[model samples]
Target: MPPKRAFDAELQALEALRQATPEEALPHLTKTLTHRNNFLVSKAATLAQHHNLTALAPNLAEAFPRFLADAPKSDPQCWAKNAIAKALAHFEYQDPDLYLIGMRHLQPEPVWGGNEDTAGPLRSTCALALVQCRTINSHKLLLHLIPLLADKELNVRVNAARAIEQTGTDSSALLLRLRAELASDSPELLGACYAGVLSLEGPSAIPWAARFLPPEDDAAAEAAMAIAQTHTPEAVDILKSTHKRARDPWFRKATLSALALTRQQSATDYLLHLIEQDTQTADAREALMLSAPSPETLSRLQQLAPNPNN
Candidate 1:
């Protein structure tokens, strides 16, 4: 009956359920979903999701609000709520209200000096899930999601951008562009926005992203990386031009790294040229290796700059 022993027994029981037939596991999983322990409830919800137990979604739903009622104590880290929401999302639960509730929920538990909101992950998960809800049109969803782009949590903002990207609307692309322009700090967030715009608008948007390549800030690096992800000849050209124009060594290195990520033959050839010409040789070599270049490229690199150790 001790807490630790009870926890161990519960874990063993959950593990055992993994081996049972779906029918046999259902009742046990259902019962465990109601357990007071947040950890156990989280594990049970994960099992439910893993096994594709759509049948227990209602139970998972019930447990979600129960934990939310006294979130700080009942779900210190929003563990139970997070798991349940993820499971529900996996099931493609169509109800927008539940996701809406979770997207707005904020549970700030006590930290060392003050209270830190533990519900950011929960909000992020719900935001992503909300995108899949067919009932809510893109406009309404964006209305709800737009505010989260400025969320206090960096991860939440990043995921919020991703969720908007999932909307795949022209409006969504514009929203990302606006965010990318307005966000002065948080390169990661800018990266997400850049990626979203690239994804939504395709190759034509490369120029728009390239504009950010100036100023040689972290935002520029993010823009370079995002453009490189396109893996198009245009991307290679854009990166190459940017690399040539960059006076900042850091920006040049970052552009080379992005060029390597493109995996295009032209990008590879350009990097090899840099190494052979002894222009940013170390960085070019590092970029080539990091890109996992083709065997021919690798052989050429070795020839151009033979390894002393090899």
Candidate 2:
């Protein structure tokens, strides 16, 4: 089929799937499940999701291993891994605890989104998948991922950090180790260190991050945003005293965002003042929104603005 024609057909089928009554949809969905076409099988899965077709989720699992074991080697393995993640992500939402059993079936698989050569993609994506299973039961995944802290791959370390954040678990030692690595001169290692610490103790990082922040003109702004999570009373004391503070708006913006995360209610007035000073910038607008006063606090922001015309 011509590309557009095939797409049009798929869209029509999807619309029909969406419109079908649950009773009517189940049998057609069952027929589609037998389809060898990858396109149809996944579309059926999506329809199953839209209709809350809980019964079909397990049936869909019948084809999942093929979707994994059959991945052609020449193509990037990440695509297959990501498909597995998407499938598992949707299914686990139906029964959160099923993830423990499901993950055991999926482990040691290839990484979905990380660099392919190293184990980064597999480890990182696995960690993320486990994290998504949080709604099902995070403790199981948390127990499984803890040992990964000793994983030699820096990318794995970064992702494991994300997993910990999603689970809201503690990893003070790993975070401190990452914080210590922030002193390294190597940018990649330093980037990994910063990425790892952003979730658990963003404020605790101020002391270490202040020393290693790249020059404003360098392309390390994203890393700076990640690293800035460590800014806090324990960390930002360093930011407050940094010697060559960069002229970059983003770097400054990251620092301010971190500061806002501290919830220093006393600093609310200062934060509100800064947001007003840069009404046109999205970062400022976001920081203002984040700092919204609680029931105990009054509305400090007076400027009601629309989203920028991005």
User: Best candidate, TM-score-wise?
Assistant: 1
lDDT of each: 0.93, 0.53
Q: List the residue pairs that clash in candidate 1.
A: none
TM-score of 1: 0.95
Residue 91 error for model 2, in Å? 2.7
| Local accuracy of candidate 2 as per-residue lDDT tens digits, 1-310 | 9977976786587669788887788988777766555566667767776777777766665655555443443223334334434554655544443333333332333557643343355556566666765354555666776666556666665566556656654554365345445444334544555555555545554445544565642225435445435434543344433312546676666555654554555334445555556632466457646755564333445443344552
Ten contiguous residues with the weakest lDDT in model 2:
98-107
TM-score of 2: 0.54
Residue-level lDDT tens digits of model 1 in 145-242: 99898799999999999999999999999999999889664999999999999998889999999999988999899999999999999999999999
Each model's TM-score? 0.95, 0.54
Regions of candidate 2 where Cα sits further than 4 Å from its true position: 1-11, 21-23, 73-84, 93-126, 131-160, 167-176, 179-198, 201-250, 253-268, 271-310
State which candidate has the highest lDDT. 1
